[model samples]
Target: MSDTAREGDAEGSGVSEGASGRTDAHESGAERTAASDESSTDAREPPRLDGWPLVGNTVEFVRDPFGFYDRLESRGDAVRYSVAGDEFCTFFDPDYVEQILVAENERFRKAQILRDSAAGFAEQGLLLTEGEVWRDQRVRIQPAFTPEKIRGYADAMVTYADRLCDNLADGEVVDVGDAMSELTLKILAKSLFDVDVAGRRAVVREATAALNDRGDASGASAFLPDWVPTPKNRRFERAMSDFESMVDDLIAERRTGDESEYDDLLSILLDAEGPDGTTMSEAEVRDQMVTFLFAGHETTSLALTYAWHLLGRNPDELERLRAELDAELGDRRATMADLPDLPYTDRVLKETLRLYPPAYVIFREPTEDVRVGPYHVREGTNLTLPVFEIHRDDRFYDDPDEFRPDRWRDDFESELPDYAYFPFGGGPRHCIGMRFATAELRLVLATMARELAFEPTYDGDPDLTMAATLRPENPLEMRVERR
Candidate 1:
């Protein structure tokens, strides 16, 4: 079960979530006033959340990350510790998360763990790069995900969802998680690659799952070198080899085929100019395609999985959601234009993300010394910002653990800290696929809810496991009833 303990409350301290400038020394000093006695710096070191010797917090964290981070919040705003011989100071404050991700972004880079974890598969993709390289790649890729372009895929999303649902019977039990996975992948492949992956869906799913599981396992073994061929590493290598081969075949086929009718993301990426004004190389294009394939579908599927599970647990909320969908899109499929009218559906997605953000935690490393709250973190020190913990912090949320989409019905975005609910992350590195994912989620939910009402058979919240994204420990099995 998820822990709901409130060990300490250091409210009204730290930089204001909306503060425009880097946190001033005065503010940092003021925030220190609320730090626990253990955090006081007479000893000249930050408060350490000590764990088992040598291996440190690695084992415990891998075993129960949610509970470990939940308990750490009570320790202090900045809690220092060693995991796998590497020192880290986790910042549970939104102000700190914003500083690292935005205002002082230039002073930090993507965490080594994140880069290493995705390196072999997503080598030099936008997600792992920093500095001018990332800037150029972002510029080149930005056009493919604009509002207008994403809207163009609406019909494809609805069409694919309908087709997927056609395979379901009104009274049969289905693995909702697996179903969503296939549906989202099909939609992504058709809309972005302009290809149908229905025949290869199982291969793509299996490969992605293996990669994610291996990534999570590698992350847990914090100090292990990437070159080491552990069992999980070997599995990842095999999966990557298969995934790359498939992606290569797709790219080669697209290259040799006629381009006059091509208007998909792959075509745009191929035609995009690099910083030097030359066309991107085939290798670069392949890297980007692989990155998008994994990102564009994986987390979105997980979000849908969590949405159904959350709705099933809260029938009243589910009813309200269904009412909105029924009234706004009665007996009709949802289009991109209708998304604005489905306020309750939007709120439910926001609430589901708040409770179970797919990209739940982010890791970073400072390029220079940084002062966050009362602590002085040295340059190159690893820092972790747990969005999962931050979202549930009582200072920013009421009854933070409860499911309440109603909170978003109000102008909660303006009322709360900007960083409080960053499901897509923040700053320049914010997910480029944000617009596409939102439109896809809203449209899929509208279509699915309009056609069928799901009744989850499980008794409690779906068990969570740490993967490339947070996923259910088991397939989200539910009884599907056509409406």
Candidate 2:
């Protein structure tokens, strides 16, 4: 997919300029602040929208995040607000997003809100850590997702997808969202651990759902101490405990068996080392395993669910995709080798990811005082990168909301700036499993298109839910007909 970069260097006057958008990159500490003094929105602090006494915009945000942010976008490039006693800056510009994630990444760190919310569930996994430790963990984890390693996982993904379809009959109505979730989880377990998690799928699914719900709640009251046992908090604890036990058992099973027996992500991680020449402890390994289970499966499942939902509504796109699949692999299951020949199918999935990115929004906090555009941001300032808004910004995409796979036909993505459509994110912290997820998504979409025809049970868009990842609020129910 083509991504057109905006003009002007990111380093010019410490401002990253896109086609029309501009954001200030927090350069050398003192110099950046000096430059910000001359900016247009030169205020003592970022623009703040007034709110209630203590809760700030928490209620409105919890009630409807997308709508709240969409409304906030009209106010300014960056809007500061208080939430549950703390302050935050919500950035709508892609240039600002890029600055925080790339050019001046060192000045920022992963938001503590996420770490506190997921701590019990994910522990000290790479997703939560920062600084040298995070860098080391990333180095250790990077090799597992290398191109060669991901290509090795394609067959397992396709095999599991086929297995999920085996029991379905033509014209049978099924919850594609639930099915995709289950299928991806199974694929994750097999692909990562070389184990069948189908037996424990119920436990894993239930636990994950509870955690996501609790996480959403946690975001609203992040200032609350973790020891407080609210009813919801108690339930979340139980779910995390259950998941941890399962992971511990899985690790134990591997320990007793031959580590040399399988070549999976678990094996690689178990043997991976930090830059300091230290191997990961078993507990650390368990944390990473759980992280992969959720991150690996949830996002991919959402992509598949949306792909089918969009295809059901857009027959022309569906036929075009099927045409590519038919022309490439008439009657056989799609393999990694067939990726080059499946360009249209690739575009369909790409478009789906753009419209419905699972990791839709990310939060970061400045390690020190910083400058974002004309605003002077203080240390410990919470910054939110609203990727969803940027992806749909009409400044970059012609019909920002439409599902047009044909838009990706040639150098479309290449024509846009990097942060404009980062479904998997970008820069040093870009998702390590991107290549793996891409391969899995394309193969599953291709395989399903070749095997079944999907018809949506309900018309219009599916209700969206933002858990840890964005997903359909309800089951994406569809009637399936065999090809």
Give the candidate number with the greatest lDDT.
Answer: 2
CA shift of 183, model 1, Å: 0.7
Worst 10-residue lDDT window for candidate 1 reads 1-10
lDDT of 1 by residue, 1-483 (tens): 000111011111112321222234224433542442233343344688878878788887777777778778889888887767777778887767766665655668888767766758777677777888777787778767766788889998999888877777888998998889989998899889998887877668877887677766325542466678887677777887887788898988898989767887898788877768887777778788888888999989988888888887888998898898888877888898888788888888988888998888888997766565556777677788887888888998899989999988566765776467777765567677777788888888888876776789888887787777888878889998786
What are the lDDT figures for the candidates, one per model?
A: 0.75, 0.75
lDDT of 2 by residue, 1-483 (tens): 222112223222111232122332223322543464454345467678888887898887778877888878888889998777778888887766766776666678888777666758777687777777767777677666666777788889999888877878999999998899898998878877888897888778877787677666325544465677766578778877888889999988998998998777787778776666778887888788888888888888888989999999988888888888888999898888898788888788878888898888888998877777666788887788877788788888889899998888667765665577777665556666676787898898888787787899997998776677886777889999787
RMSD of each: 6.4, 5.0
Error of 1 at 347 (Å): 0.4
Minimum summed lDDT over a 10-residue window in model 2 is located at 10-19
Off by over 4 Å in 1: 1-45, 217-223
